[model samples]
Target: MDLNALDDFQLVAAHGGFGRASRASGRSKATLSRRVTELEEALGVRLVERGARSLQLTEAGQQLLARTEGPMYEVADAIAAVREGVATPRGNLRIAAPSLFGQLALGTLVARFRTLYPDVEIEVVADDRRVNLVEEQFDIAIRIDPDPDTALVGRCFARDRLVLAAPPLLAPPSGDLDEVVPVPAVVMPSYREGDIWTLRDRAPRLLPRPVLRLSSLLMVRDAIVAGAGVGLVPQSIIGGQLQRGELVSWGTRGGDVALWVLHTSRRLQSPKVRAFVEFLCDQYPDKAFLASV
Candidate 1:
């Protein structure tokens, strides 16, 4: 199979059609179409369904693109590095992060990164879904308490602990250490009835009466701030509110959860990836935003 033809086919599929691919690559539409045809002939499979007004990839084309896109970009990066003597952070860097974390922290960090490396382009996808980094072509992923994956390697950038917090007016009065207080609570969808919250070792337990169920932690925090009810929220996210006296922390909940900056476990780390990981570590030098209270 012709590698150049395969590359051209990928370019066309990625850009949706021959004309757009041609415009993006500075190659004529006729040449791109011919290359794709040659690739299909060599592979003995139809890759694209070309139409007058629209273009669609066959199932085979979609599979091939999914399997090869990440490797293709890696190969391109390798070649570019060899040609340039030193690999500088100058290409697109795609990042995947949790929605709340992205909204709370990424804006400032990303802005600082762009100022330092003006040549690199960034795209951040903020979704809570656990993504397959290699298959999805994400350069980096910021995850909280990620499961063990041999295909990935990363460093823990920061650690956070959950705190049962509430507006000062709604917070239950401090009582006996062993007492279980039933408080109206804003809870996550995962919270269940009769579930007792052990905020900390030797600390009083909370029997939360679910007043509101929210889909995201951000929503739960907002509800708690508005005097909805007590809620379990991450200290990193709610620290400012607690310090400003907008909310009162009952106590820490569970063990600390580590925030990691992860990438594919490839032998060679791209300069861009290395730079970003280092920047994250620097930002959280203590590996935690706030101490557990």
Candidate 2:
């Protein structure tokens, strides 16, 4: 039968009856009725069972809808595949990320992603504040903690550790393990929670407090490395610095946190978002960070 007839049948099924389908499909009711009649004639079967108030699909129509749905979806996917191939993930990918990760991690990843998907624009919005993914229209968000919204799908890139560290110059006044230095620290704002500055735990003990406070991790890391004070940071971000002796670890293993790529739940499997999430996972392997910690 003609695809136009199938289209009309699909529209009728989708919209429940000819009149409604006609309005939805932008065809007059008479035209839609004629198309359905022609389709049934061509197929040599009555597709719809007529009732006073509504149309119900006959066995043949139900079978046809079932059979055609998969193929129709395949056809649509094929068209989209070609379009995506031609366009090359070619659209703006709006991303929201914390400032430190944006500066230290995403710049390189975005550079590489741009190199691969040259036509795609990576719009990076670097803020320490959380943004509403749906409301803000962000394609992806690099988040450091659990994404509490069930509306978002979180893909694990890697787990990170918060290293409590000081510059070598400011290690300790007495070089004593028990001595805690009261040092200036820039920290993530109280909006994130000020009660706990997380640390590597003993089998029993937990410590949480920062002597001084500020709003951004980037600011905190800079201040720590500059001998301003000891503060927490992701080891993935400061591995090289630790090796270079720019910072010294306050604990043997570092504190724990996970890094995740958060996207809208429904779009988790979208090609562009999927590609980026996989790229991030490959870039920051868990084993490598685990090895460091």
Candidate 3:
């Protein structure tokens, strides 16, 4: 009935003393003491026993405390919901990604994400090196690695394949991986596993004649698309190209290279980061989109 007094009594009960409650709530001890007394008088029951050592809640106080917690929490949640709705998912979200992944996939993904949620502006720093996400102040990091950083929590959203691919005009897949490796090819950093091409059933030290060595995977893809060379490329980057007959899978698909969304544990609560992670996962479902695209 008396909400203010009821709140004061709850605070006193929680703190175990009027002086403690007053200090915590920034109210005078006299005010808190008076509020609880008024609450007891209004309820026609004894709410607390003000003693020398501590204030002990009576049976009535205990009952009221039990019933009031739920209502108080509900009120607090309702206020929070409104505030969150007004402010969340509207600020700039900084992302750190590998250069190749950023150019090919993340660019399109971020475009689509912005189209859906216009308020969230994205800033991406593309580099192949693994930067410290927390030190960089990045909201999330898109990484292609076998194992993500141990300090950060990550979600493996997509398992990308390293595929030997070329433009349809160059040469079609004859189901011969050994024959394909000798072909003049373009090579990027990710495709090289300790100086050997990562293709299925591949022989050791087979990649010898890469025609063009580009630093950027995006450039390598362009060269392959232009029929400049046959090369190993990420399935995630070129799936749609393969589907559209722009590029053909020339040789064997390589081992699964996991793509991770890495972030600090503290950043898990960010609304924009959460929304983007879910959005990215939705794009790359369980089944590969290579055939569908």
Candidate 4:
């Protein structure tokens, strides 16, 4: 099978239709359709179910696209590496990050990076769902306390910990350090019945009485500030609120959580990726900014 035909097929599949793919690649719609047809013929299967107003990929097509997208991106990155050896970073830089970090910190970081390296275009997707870097074609991912994965490699740029926070009026009275205070709490959906919060170094244990359950930490913080209940949130996200006395920290919870900027181990360190990692490391040389963000 011709690689060019396969590439064209992937492009059309990626962009959802031949017309958009044509506009994106500066190739005629007829040419893209012909290429996909040729690819389908070579493979002896129908890849696309073409329609007047829509395009849909067959099961085989979906499988093919999913399997090949990562390798194709790797190939492009390899070509780019050789064409621009140790040169100025130029190209699209796709990033995936946790929603809280993305909202609180990533925008500013991306803006600064862009100002320094004007050639690099950035796209950031902020969601809590763990994305497969290779399958998703992401240049980097910023994860908090990521689990061990042999397929990923990167540096832990910062450390953060969870803190119990609440409005001053609603905060549990500080009477006994060893007492398990039963506080009305705004918690994540993961918090279940009888789940007690153990503070770092054996500080007062919090027996959270769930008053409200939120899906995201941002929402939990808002609820806590609104006096709904005390919340356990990452210190990084609530630094400003804590400093401004909008929310008072009850105490730190558990141990430190490391924040990492990671990339696929299989891919070469493209100039764009290297520059971004370096930019992040330079910004947080002592791993303090993230901890306090």
Q: TM-score of every model?
A: 0.68, 0.60, 0.61, 0.67
lDDT of 4 by residue, 1-293 (tens): 78789899999998999999999999999999999999998999999999997899999999999999899889888989778765778889999999888888889999999999998999999998999898899989999888999989999898888888989887455545667778899999998899978776545677889999889888999999899989889888888888898999877888888899999863667888999998998888888646433
lDDT tens per residue, model 2, 96-176: 987777777678888988887777778999987988888889988888776477788867777767676778886433333
Instruction: List candidate 3 segments past 4 Å from native.
Output: 1-87, 146-148, 167-181, 189-198, 201-205, 244-246, 266-268, 287-293
**In candidate 2, which residue ranges exceed 4 Å CA deviation?**
1-3, 6-88, 169-214, 252-255, 266-268, 287-293
- Which candidate number maximizes TM-score? 1
Ranking by lDDT: 4, 1, 3, 2
For model 4, give the 10-residue run with minimal summed lDDT: 170-179
lDDT against the true structure, per candidate, is 0.87, 0.72, 0.75, 0.87
- Candidate 4 residue spans exceeding 4 A from truth: 1-86, 171-179, 266-268, 289-293
Candidate 1 regions with alpha-carbon error over 4 angstroms: 1-81, 171-179, 290-293
C-alpha RMSD of each candidate structure in angstroms: 15.4, 11.4, 10.2, 16.2
Angstrom error at residue 159, model 3: 2.5
lDDT of 2 at 91: 66
Per-residue lDDT of model 1, residues 1-293, tens digit only: 78788899899998999989999999999999999999889889999999997789999999989998898899889889776633677788999998878888887888899999897889999999999888899999999999999889999988888888989987455656678878899999999899988867545677889999999888999999999989999887787788899999888888999999999964788878888998878888889663322
Cα lDDT, model 2, residue 165: 72
